[model samples]
Target: MTEVAEICSELLRIDTTNDGGGDGPGERRAAEYVAGLLDEVGIEPHVFESAPGRTSVVARVPGDDPDGLLVHGHLDVVPADPAEWRVHPFSGEIADGCVHGRGAVDMKGTLSMTLAWARENARRGARPRRDLVLAFLADEEATGAYGAGHAIERHRDLFEGCSEAISESGGFTWHEGDVRIYPVAVGERGTAWMRLTARGVAGHGSKPAVDNPVAELARAVARLADHRWPVRLTPEVARLIDELSRALGAPIDVDRLEEEIRRVPRAAALFRGVLRNSANPTMLNAGYKVNVIPGSAEAHVDGRFLPGQRDEFLETVDRLLGPKVTREFVSFEEAVSSPAEGLFDDLTAALLAEDPGGRPVPYVMTGGTDAKWFARIGIRGYGFAPLFLPPGLDYFGMFHGVDERVPVEGLEFGVRVLDRLLSSESSTM
Candidate 1:
């Protein structure tokens, strides 16, 4: 097999930063690079650009069976400042036995493993048990509108027979004493990115203003920020707690979940973010100048609700902001869940086969991914990007953190695990 690290370093050198805003340089260069790599191995690649220079690449490698498994990763990384890093963020430097770069862990590293594995398979004339639909997507750091969303909306036929998908955000090693716990994400919290607007009569600097929009919005923002969201565990989270309890050989009291979690901090860390609904005031805007009380004020909130808690979450937000403020969605996407029985077992088996010391568990992601977009088309997605890291590596904190990097050995381990999973007959629908 080809050196996955070399592919990763090459990819990281290409700066494909998605700044959420539309104006950043798009993923065209990276998409072309990915296309060329696949083409070199004789795998026909289909490249799509939703807008000018916003590109995504897709290819279907035929297998022994007609059933398909979609393996995907985004080509973009969250923007990084070069001054804040030990190495330049865009320079895909290999140092201290790790690949250091912006997208090393956030996604491009995983894409490298996929690309290298696929290339090796193609070169050897090897085929997976199930057809592999490889998608190197764009815009996942934002809303995936130019990536998975566009593909699903305009070109649904690209993923015709695919029933399940594996993507970013899971299958990494989480240490629990001697055992390495690998959490496989079966679901994720729904996104309710909302924009709140408050309107009041314009007023002078020193005037006694009763209906100050700024004050009204500030109070609402504070309430939303400080309000304690009740614990509402969905099926996936509940299952995770149960699995952890068994794995650790300690009972977890659901009623006293906060207290119980304190005892098993390591296991609790896995699902702490998805235990309840969360809303934090991310951005606030009120007055143009300090003196004048603006007629209108607005704020943006980052809100996430557990699966099946959307109605209750929205209702509570409306009540907290009161009658003065009205809210609209900046971007809204539903929570998604896939069965953790069949293909999930296949994933577990693959991981265990690769590393006997590893224990596989199901988890629900706190943040959203391209999985939710693909869920719209009845495709179940799982977070199955496998990586095995040495102890002391803060894998979770490096998602978009400074000095984001992935261990070279971890990428190699992932390649092996992926090969085993794809070769399994049970992977087919």
Candidate 2:
């Protein structure tokens, strides 16, 4: 296999699924694999565990004191079903110029690039102007409680004075039919996970049951999925609109911006299904036997918030899911609060230099990430996992979808951009 293919395969073989399901919880073997590789390259890793098996490791390529840049990616990923997937999720198959498996896209692909970079930089003894911190984290697929959350809570000093960090998104090569644009995620929406339960009368399935809990759960699920999140206009969205206007060479109505946003290559992905506040009924529990109608049913919903809109998001959630639902932070990552001033300047220059035809626009990921944890310590989190995807390929759908994979060439392209970024961003500081 080629280099990028190799990276994807190796990571795929690691089986780092998150706590929501599958092979995760304890990142021991996966973390050890990364830590061992870094060790081979002579970087001592600082490994921390939140629980037996759960782990987050940090290896610093030491640089100037006080302010360092952290490059992070999570190890855990959402579970995959072999029955639904074309390839075994953990088989780490490299085929047809792509690496196929779970975490291949949602991250592991990006993580592999970071690992490759560590080797490239370490081999050259290249010294960053600021300390370069590499975090091979776990539990991001869950709440990050055992991964980044634990690291921040327990190993705050390791990230001491970190000003900014980069992670597994954005800055990748995107193939528009005519243009290649790298959408850098400067921010992400906050997450609010809620648990809902409906309790009613239990009865024999043979008998016509009324007020059945299962029926209530089905209603609640419909309510959550049908409820729309209020359209929020954020600084990131405004920037995106500006870019699209220039690209289309016409005034794309801001009111119908959602449709216009979809016109831009993969970013049309940003306008995915239900392009608003969303609540998903991910899990459901009911009666065990067919002979009985369960009296109690439960479900979990994932909701998101725009930056500085957490309180408002909470209010919306309360109104939509109903007060009976138990609201909680399934995965809480604060939306980037501060403006990305110099950070974007450097990133934009890098993208422009790499793909002059490509547009580097600001984006706000609708999901949560470890970036939220880093943002807490005064570190600005930018999703800059560079990739150049070919047209017609739905990149977002590959998050954990069947035959999840990354382009062989795209990985190489990402490494080139990352190399320039690490070189350019570090020197400028």
Candidate 3:
């Protein structure tokens, strides 16, 4: 089998689901399998178990320069609903020329690419200006507490002598008239997962009561969804937009732009979603029966904030919901700082070399990842899962959607681009 095929098969065979996290993040089988390959290639791999079953493996590619580079990816994937997938989530089935499985595009495909590149480099006795670190982590779906987060907190020495790193993120295709500029992800939004408690007096459902928490909670949820935050343009984001506009050979007028953004269907649909502070009430709890008016209601929200905008975002949400709603943060991760365009140009070259007709663009990730945690320790990461998604497919919607599968050629394209970038002088890593 080819490198992409082999790694894809290996990843599919291991069910590193996050549901097994309590007993350890369930990456033991996957990590061990990856270790075997490293051993075969003469690279001593270090495997650590955060919990009973959650295992993390780290391997380094010896380089010419003393400066070290770390390429990290999560082994654990979010639980896949078996009933929803066309192929068995763990079957590693290659149908219609594409590998079908959980974590295929999320990061596993990228991991496979990195592994194959490392092995080939080692075999050729090829070394770069810096050492290369490959970390296959566990427990990213929930938090990095057991994975990359743990590595940074517990094994700080593991990343010693490293100046730069690249991970799965920030690089993807976007159509803007005629230009296809690949955007190397420079930053991400901060993550805030919060729980809110709404309290009121309980009463009989038959008797109309005013102090019902459920009613109050419904109002709060509506406002959270409908409310919009003011747009704050940061340098990187503005540059990304400007580059895209320039590449398309279109003029951007800052004053009427907001109106244009709100009116233009395609541009509005894509850019507006992740532009500002966002609040989503994903889980809710209230009365158990159909007749009772619950005294208290509980709900959890997945909120994201731009860099340095957390304080304002929380304040706004609090005010909009009124004093009845009290919130507590379950987890808080800050937005990461992004690198400049020079690195991105190298990525564009990588993409062009692989497929000359493909278009790449910069994006502002509306979600959070291990990249949030790595920023503090001086590591720059991006959300770069490269693919040639069809126009009508809605790439963003596929993440938690049913039948999530990547094209076979898209995977190959990404592997080739990534490998080319890794070996080039232009790549910061």
Q: Estimate each model's TM-score.
A: 0.97, 0.85, 0.88
Q: Which one wins on TM-score?
A: 1
TM-score of 2: 0.85
Residue 326 accuracy (lDDT) in model 2: 48
For all candidates in order, the CA lDDT equals 0.89, 0.74, 0.72
Across 292-402, the per-residue lDDT of candidate 2 in tens digits comes to 888788888776667777777667666665544445565555566445568777777777766778877777787878888877777888888878787766777787678
Q: By lDDT, highest first, what's the ranking? A: 1, 2, 3
Clashes of each: 0, 9, 9
Clashes of 3: 9
**Candidate 1 stretches greater than 4 Å from native:** 24-26, 424-429
- For candidate 3, give the lDDT of residue 178: 47
* Angstrom error at residue 140, model 2: 1.2
| Weakest lDDT window of 10 consecutive positions for candidate 2 | 420-429
Return the clash pairs for model 1, or none. Answer: none
Over 1-429, each residue of candidate 3 has an lDDT whose tens digit, in order, gives: 577677876787688778633654448888998888778878889888766777889887767666776778888777888887788888888887677788776767777877776666666656654677888888877788888877888877778876667776656555544444455566778888899889998888899878989888889988998896777776666766676566556655555657757554454444455567788989999998888898999899999888778888989889877889888998888877666665566666677777687656666676767776677788766666566544544555556555556666666666666667766342311
Can you tell me which runs of candidate 2 are displaced by over 4 Å?
A: 1-5, 19-26, 64-66, 83-87, 198-222, 258-267, 271-275, 286-297, 321-333, 424-429
